[model samples]
Target: MKKLSSLGLLFLLILFLSGVSQIAFAAENPQYGGTLHLSNDADWDTLDPAYASGFDAGEMAVKFYDGLVRFDFSSNKIVADLAESWEVKNNNQNFIFHLRKGVKFHNGVEFTAQDVKYTFERLYDPEVASPGTWVYPMIKGTAAKLAGESAELAGVKVIDDYTIEFDLSEPFGLFLTHLTLPYGLIVNQSAVEKYGADFSQHPVGTGPFKFVEWEHDNKLVMKANQDYWAGRPYVDQVIYRVIPQPLTDIAEFEANNLDRTVVPEEERERWLNDPEWSDYITTIADLSTYYLALNSDFEPLDNPQVREAINYAIDSKTITDSLFPYYVAANDAIPEGMPGGSDLPIKADPEKAKQLLTEAGYPDGFELDIWVSDSSTSVRVGGVLQALLGRVGIQVNLIKNDWSVFYNTVKNGNAPAYYLSWWADYADPYNFLNALYTTDRIPFNNQEINSLLKEMTITTDTDQRIRLSQQIIKLADQVGDPYIYLYHTSTSYVKHPWVKGDLYHQMYTADKLLTWWIDQDLKAESTN
Candidate 1:
């Protein structure tokens, strides 16, 4: 009896281990290699990670690029990609990264610590005009170089072929986290040399996937990097079909020509109601804020009180209903669940907002042009913002244009006071308020806000510093420099019934694809 009981326990242990092993996809197994088709409503603006600015471009690059550090969206934690392991100096002024051994770029060039050092230095080089330059200011002379005012960035040093040490001039607890920024993604030096201005058009990286080809608006393809340090991807290829219009995306998915497409917001439920399609639909709360950016240097927006008043002018509840129904939640400038000061509060007060505008000398309100992209949803967002301001007596002359022109105008910081857009980068409150508002940081910044942000950078204790950070967050709520606190996005990616497993939409879906697979019955339909 004792022998029989011991044998039973052993068998149960083996069963448990087998289940765990299958879940992690450990040990040897046949690779389920195949191609996947994904479509998005917007086309990628550029493929260069260093210069990729919007979600439209950045998400497309994630299929083929790997950053030194990347965020695990499901866990909201930084995990290694290019670097194997790392440690932060006690003063928060240094981080040493140990690169994985025997890894090579898609172009077959050996990667070294020098590549890491050069990447940051090049980004800080004003001639490159890399938008990621804002992240290197803690490297002492980085700011000057980024502005074309100086020559060298003083922080990066290669200790050896496999190791690199980064010395920050100031401490930032979120520094490692910021390393997950799109601008910090790894690129092939060989490809850049070979492709030149065409590098973006034909890129290469050390990610789990390798770029195959991009046929413009038709399709973009990538194949599995079997030698990937993270292990082989389940699907061998990811083919992105560029479907610019939301309606077109819907029609293609329904017609079965496309395997998957970004589900049109209005048709999510329609798919959900269809049993054949409902099982294929998946939702990931877009940890993104789609809102308007006020050009602080513009006429009416130059007044801080007027900005504060505009914050109270919008009725967000109405916009969320009209635009996305109950699919969104009210959002402050900063995304939810991020570390923040205890003092911050979300705002809404039409009466007080109008009074503040009157005090700012716009008693009869002001006439202004609000700019938006040509996308249908973008137009809807702009129109609602126009109506919200109208309620507060500000007559908004809505100006619509293509996304490329809209982004360029806003980035120049010479926008006509109102421009609508969103941030999908960075997962902290500082990103929304401090990074965007402060001077010497980003495209739209103010010197006064910049002064306060410098202080937040120096405070090391997590809690104490969060207090200083909170002050700015509260200020954002009060003034609404670039936002009136609209709703955060909740979107669905509805696919065909055969589509079983897929990545979620935390804006970093590509990183979590190992867990996804096509249904057994539908596997035959997937094209390689």
Candidate 2:
């Protein structure tokens, strides 16, 4: 969205010939009184920032919550959000933040350093079982606190009502970057206490928008916060209507009932080539990687040679080539353009694959079941994989499950193989590498990678950190073999010409909606 750097040159030439000014038409001036209509295919999991791990939940969380620090796409850096300013102390091992004054949660409770302390402690709470504890591994007493030996997060110090300090056990280079995630978003203790278990349904935070209503499987609405620390959002209201299908979302957008909708993979080419729709196509190359996960805990796959054989069997370049403009072949663990991202010397070799399978005692190939989520993209990708692996004498049975079943199966390490993607929470190579490799998600255990990942966190030098991460990635490819790197994702959306200041950012969970405003005159003109 920033510059269309990844868009096809031929598409740009088409736009030029058709007299279209930009990929996504944005009005020069903004009008502030319209409701921004949008559609989501699934319902939000939760509104509470701490428990919101799914993308849909995060999309809602960013509207209703404010993290200490947030990604600033305009500058492509981490900028202060709730904290007015911050300073590093004790040789980058401690962070002292000066909080903004007079910020109020949706429930009208004033925000303070106590809220920050409460939020981190809540994340580390053993009873909570939150998925966010990984974001604060460098903090002092993290192990003890998570192990339930300590009640307090000793590192989190409330200096005063308006100031807070975090003492890290080591000098973590991405400390500020980690704080940009929704996990670091501050919440009022009183609000959480009041809602108790229902806190997720009723979120209270000091963001640009306040939660108003949610009709399950229908629509969720948020109104602009009049007393927001920052100025109010340009749009008076933001509405997310749940339209279960991509085709329905596109239909709603065409009917002028929705502001924008994602272009389905099947429909992207037609929309891109059609002169009538080409101008509205907004494509963003995100910091994400889609891959085929081979669970090492499972038999046969546990053999490194078998894993390598599987990798060599599938032609990733060919798959990505067919999905052109939407994706690029992923050569390494880290995505291209990010630090430590590189092109690895890996390719499909049917002969080598067959040789390795025989060496691993699977000469006639073996039956393996690959669980796939019930999304259209995942199913389509699974079919391609089934065909590719069959070529090398490996029979892959595709098991398509709904999101809940697929997620739990993978999380519980029950899936021998699965199709998944990793999108960045922060624009760091560490986020991608640490998430896919270290977690039980894929059950990959590489001592070399594990040690390097630990060192990567505390390494303050940028180049040194990059080198360590790159080494870890290469090791994962050569030895770990947990996943067959597929492709990096690019998302395209059809946006209305009246939508102003909307940018498809790398950090999609950040509050991009606050900057978007509807051009009333243009909307009226288009409607006429």
Candidate 3:
């Protein structure tokens, strides 16, 4: 009897120990070593930090590049990345950055202040012709370099191997934020010289991930930089698969092939309601604006009255509620939740629209072509607008083109009107105003608005800057009539249950991939 009791006790003890072990395993902190499977709708245009402008390329660049400053997604503050610290001197005209030591590029070259100088100089180099050149206009001597007056930027000076200085032409409040952009990402001078124009295909930088292979139109693979300054990333590798079809992406996510993908509009509700998928669906309010960009150079649209009529003809509420339930109807150019943003009353006024059309000498209606990318959402939106504009005696011919071709066409001012969205490169009102309204990217040009935008850049006072921003937005609306502010999008992504870490950011879409981890056991269970 004693032996039997001892044996039973031992069995119970073993069971308890096993249960404790299971609990411990479940509660343990994330373990590193799994590939994160991600998908994008399109292929990257370029990997070169200075010239990469599209979102797809920018996301990939984040993995392999480090900027002087970085925007912390959780805190929403500008924090040090390559530059450990910085100081604003000379009345905000001079910025002195103390670089972090022991950092190395993917190619094993030591990062120094000279690389920072080289990066900025290359941006100002007329030979490179980066569209991002507009980002560095405040850097002193940039104008001279662009005009062939100088070879080097006078403002960018290397104080030492670990310190660099930037002398601005004026006190630009958003200069630090600007440095956080992808354009400000530092590149190894030797690497650029080695690859030359082919550097876009083979990028090397001092980021958390190192470039491994880029199979164009298929996948761009990256491996973890074990010697990263911030500690190696949790994931072993990141595979960005190019899957253009939205439904196909969702299907792959369902099949456990893709760890992260955007939820298609048709399947969003189904996924939101499913108990299995409910926890994986994340909706993020994006700091972006979708609009119909009107070219003032295009006849009829050149008339402000006709633009106002087009804006009034479309029903924003219908579009937002029916087509894009995740989006918020926009009334003004500046999105809500930002400084200087307004929720002005903007509704479809057919009577006022008709009056404006008559005033613009289109009383009998007219035909116009509106260009859009071949994305399903863009096509649907265009179709809706076509129906609405037809009621107002305006025929809207929807012209769909491939993403790359459409972007190039619009950028070249070949499209009289285009459907597009402007995402914030940084969390600032200046980025929105300057990029959309002030740049030559849009045909609408107003001298007074331009002068106010210039003032907004230099204005430091929060209240004053807000006031100036609002004034600029109002002026653009009145004169330029550049865009019919449609709605603010809510970006939704479906993450597999095993994927851990925050993924949503106001300014950057891919920064979270650096810290994200995969639970091997859970991932295996899901797959099995």
Runs in model 1 deviating more than 4 A are: 1-31, 42-45, 125-127, 140-153, 292-309, 327-331, 336-375, 385-394, 399-416, 439-452, 455-469, 478-482, 497-501, 509-512, 522-528
How many steric overlaps does candidate 1 have?
0
Candidate 2 C-alpha lDDT tens digits along 176-268: 988877788889999999999999998889988888889999999989997888888889999999998888888889899999889987788
What C-alpha lDDT values do all the predictions have?
0.67, 0.82, 0.81
Poorest lDDT segment (10 consecutive residues) of candidate 2: 1-10
The order by descending TM-score is 2, 3, 1
What TM-score does candidate 3 reach? Answer: 0.87
Better of 1 and 3 by TM-score: 3
**Tens-place lDDT digits, model 3, residues 1-528:** 011123223333433454454455457687899899998888899999888777777777888999998877453478888999999987678899999999999899999999999999988888888888878898999989987789999999999999999999888878988887778899999999999889999989999998899898999899999999889988999998999888999999888899988888777778878898887776666678888888878898888888889888877877887798756777766654557765456658887788889988999789989999998889999998888889899998999999999999998888988999888887778878878876575677778888988888776677888888778777766673678888877656788888876345666633836657898999899888
Q: Please report, as a residue range, the 10-residue window in candidate 3 with the lowest summed lDDT.
A: 1-10
TM-score of each: 0.80, 0.89, 0.87
Model 2, clash count? 0
Residue 283's lDDT in candidate 3: 65
